[model samples]
Target chain A: MIFKIAWRNIWRSKLRSFTVMGSVIIGVWSLSFMLAFFAGFIEAYVSSAIENDLSHIQLHHPDFKKDKEVQYRLKDIEAIEKQVTSLDAVKAYTVRSLNNGMLATATGSRGVQIRGVLPEKEAAITNLDQKITTGVYFDATQKRNPILVSKRLAEKLNLSLKSKVVLTFQQANGALTSAAFKIIGLYQTGNAIFENLNVYIRQEDLSRLMGETAMIHELALLLNKKDAIEATQHYLSQHNDSTQVLVENYQQISPDVNLYESQMSVATYIMIVIIMLALIFGIINTMLMAVLERTRELGMLMAVGMNRSKVFLMIILETILLGVIAAPIGLVLGFLTNAYFGSYGIDLSSYSEGMEKFGLSDVVYTHMQTADYLLIMIAVAITAILGALYPAFKAIRLKPVEAIRKI
Target chain B: MKEVIKVQAIKKTYNAESIPVHALRGVDLSIQQGEFTALVGPSGSGKTTLLNIIGGLDAATEGSVLIDQQNISQLTDSQLIDFRKEHIGFVFQAYNLIPVLTAKENVEFVMLLQGKSQAERDARVKDLLGAVGLSEQIDRRPNQLSGGQQQRVAVARALASKPKFVLADEPTANLDSKSTADLLDIMAKLNREENITFLFSTHDQRVIDRAQRIVTLEDGAIISDEQNAIGS
Candidate 1:
């Protein structure tokens, strides 16, 4: 009977009911789109940062991180590889000597961070070879002094394939050294900053050039599970001793990506609050009008022995039912919106540059969240119930005889 | 005869600007079960005020109303609602029916408040609609029905809960003479056939002529209390 009465009461004033629901739908739609896009943008940043900038984790000689010199290499290279590979969690690790070297071309010359890498292992950590826009990757076992540079670096050097580039750096024995390499390939992963600064060379050739045998500065490890990145790092940090360890992650090495994630979280919460506020006012106004329109009916209910509390609760239940019906629809709309945007990403280039000023990537994408949808459902339901309070109180506390008389 | 309503020195006052406006000045009255009583006077004559005080809708300033031996004034808000729900029914002049409810649903409203079962609600609501001669208009909303039909629905609603007493305050004020007489006749039949008490506060001449018992008030006090008709 309460349900039947409440159902009829909703339709008693169609315009008012429609207004309330319309506001909710709009609020849900707006928040869904905003939060989803922000989520997408942040996820894109984290994945891209991890894939290109940092793998799961990187291991360095404790002092090597400070000075970044080949002389600070760990004593046993093969043993560290064996232990890390046996962990079951470790997918692959690339041993590389990463330090500054001077490169000279016919067009120009500049100092750059020259990375010495094994071709196969290096490919998994950095996608630079895969991003080759011209020529090809250097062969790992070919015993050739060939190197790959970014398109931005190539542009700076004004050089093409087969261009002989000279790289010079101090050796582990404190000896000045230089190596001439044939320019094998040029790559561009769309990041102009990285493309302009980095050069890749053969690991064996650079090891001989550094005057060190079977030694590298750091090992960058890649793992399959992303959530286990910290755990993997922790495992290595705990297992390894004797050699000082420097554990670096993209999260710390590049804090911008993490900052982006944090900002998106705050934005998502703000959107929820804004949307809920709109729903709050809408629902409150709706129930107020409902009580006014149904004054005589409520009084009649009270006169018939329905107490004030029951009157209040019944109305709250009505609004809760209203929210319950609308919640799934709102959630589906949000989920579908995220799915749609996830498949076909929005072109935010024009918007991106402006947003980049504030350190936010403008590539608007959908970051779908299961928990967020649930929270939205619970929030909307709460808002609807809260909105019913005033009217419910009025209905139960009214002087039945006088209220009916007024009607 | 058992007394359905016993108003013992019931005084009602309205607080306006914190000063009391005496609405019912020491009202003392009694109506027996199965009796039709008329409280007749002009506007502000304390007729409706005295009726409200007895219906447990408003608390008396001083005194008590014992309906079916229950002191209505002393009951808490919830207790008063329960008391009214089980023992009293009411009819108003305009908008007597819930606008959203059909004629049957409006009658069912009272029965629902009485916690009647579905089967009981359905059977009794149908019978009440027939009793009010609105069987065909049971499914129609109040706006779709004529004033006469709506008033009949209101009367059916009041009687649906099967209360010991009913307070009708200007129930026919908005009705034409035909509808007014129809409503009066239905009340009269329900009073006689069901052995329920019917009390009306009205200034309508038609209502006055039909009442077997009449009580007249001047200002906030009753000036005459008499039974003009001998027919029971």
Candidate 2:
């Protein structure tokens, strides 16, 4: 009977009830959309970092990451590559010989990290071949040492495709060396900071130039599934000499990526709290008005035998019914918005320059986990209950005699 | 006849701390079973206050109210609500039927609160609405019914719990002459046929003319208590 009465009572003032429900719908829609957008932004940032350079996992000579000297090369290059490539989880892998040195042209000299990579394997892992904008990737027909420089770096060096540049670095004996290489390709990764600091060259040419045969310093691997990364890294660790190797994933290699990933949920929680708080006050206001308007009716109910607890429960049921009617509509609206944007992403190309500086893609697709939807439903329920408390209590506190006598 | 209501030196003071308004002063009254009694007085003469105290809707400032030998003044507020549900029925002046419920539902509400099964409540609601001449208006809500029909529904609801007695405070104050006459005929018929006890606080001479006994008040004190041999 209470349920029936409460359900009918809300419709007594249809305008007021709908106004409260409209607030709930808008609150739920905005919260869900905002969280989806935040999730998309963070996903873009992390994936861009990984796809551009991080890969799923990377293995380095124990001391090589500390200093990019030629002397810290992997002890047995062939043996380690053989074991890593044989793992069932290994989707693709690449070996690179790294050297931090200076690049010079007739105009100026700038600091650079020269990455010596095998063309086929690097293409498979990082898709470096597709990033070429003007010239071809390292071709077997090239007669000289072929190098790939970013467009931003080429502008700094006053060089273009087929321009000759001199790379100056160190040998295993601590002697300084310089070699001339031809820039065969100019690539633009949209990340100005990374583009300005790094250039790629053929591994054979760099190894021969440093007076070592088959010398490699880093092994970057892309796994078939992200969840298999820790297991693959563990397998690689057991196969190799642990004292000479350090295997790490993208999060381990970049602390900022890890921080962004962990903070996504915190950001979502803050959004839920903010939206629910606003909804709470709106619901309380509406319910308080309902209770006050029906003072005589409530008093009569008590006078005729309805207890305080049942009256309290009836008010609570009314508030919850409002949420129950509004939440699903809001959820459906949010789901539709997410679906439309997810399939055809929202473009923010106008902010591309700024976004790329932080290694984030210009377009972000809105998406949310199933658990997120469940959390939102639970949050709305709690908010409704909390919002109903003061008004329900006020109703139960009215003395039947005084209330009935109220004129 | 057994005494259904016994009021012993009941006193009620409103705004007692500052400029106290004594609504009831040492009023004593006893009503027996199967009696149709009217408490009549001018404005501020303590008719409603005395009735409220006896019905357990308000606490007496001094003295006690016993309904069928139970001291209602000693009960807690929550306990008083339960006592009202189980023993006393009320018919308000404005026809205080739940606006959201149909006539039948309003009659069945108290029985539901009593935890009566559907079969029992349905049967009682059907029988009581028939008794009140609302047998055809069972599905209409209060707002849809006429003022007289609404009062009829209130009377049905008051009897739904089959309480020991019914308290009506000016139940015909809002009705037209025809509605008031029709209502008095129903109440008088019910008292005669069902032997139900009824106590009313009213200024309407129509109600006073039909009562078996009349209790009049002046200056918050009962000035006359008389039984009409043939109702005026």
Among the numbered candidates, top TM-score falls to 2
lDDT of 2 by residue, A310-376 (tens): 9999999999999999998999999899889988988999999898888777899998887898899
> For candidate 1, lDDT tens digit of each residue in A71-178?
788767787787788877777778887768789987778988888888888887776668888999876444579888887688777888888999988788878798
Model 2 regions lying over 4 Å from their true place: A156-158
- Fnat of model 1, as a fraction: 0.82
Considering only chain B, report the TM-score of each candidate against the true chain B.
Answer: 0.95, 0.98
lDDT of 2 at A201: 93
Model 2 lDDT per residue over B190-218, tens place: 89999999999999998899999999998
Best by lDDT: 2
Error of 1 at A39 (Å): 2.1
TM-scores for every predicted model: 0.90, 0.96
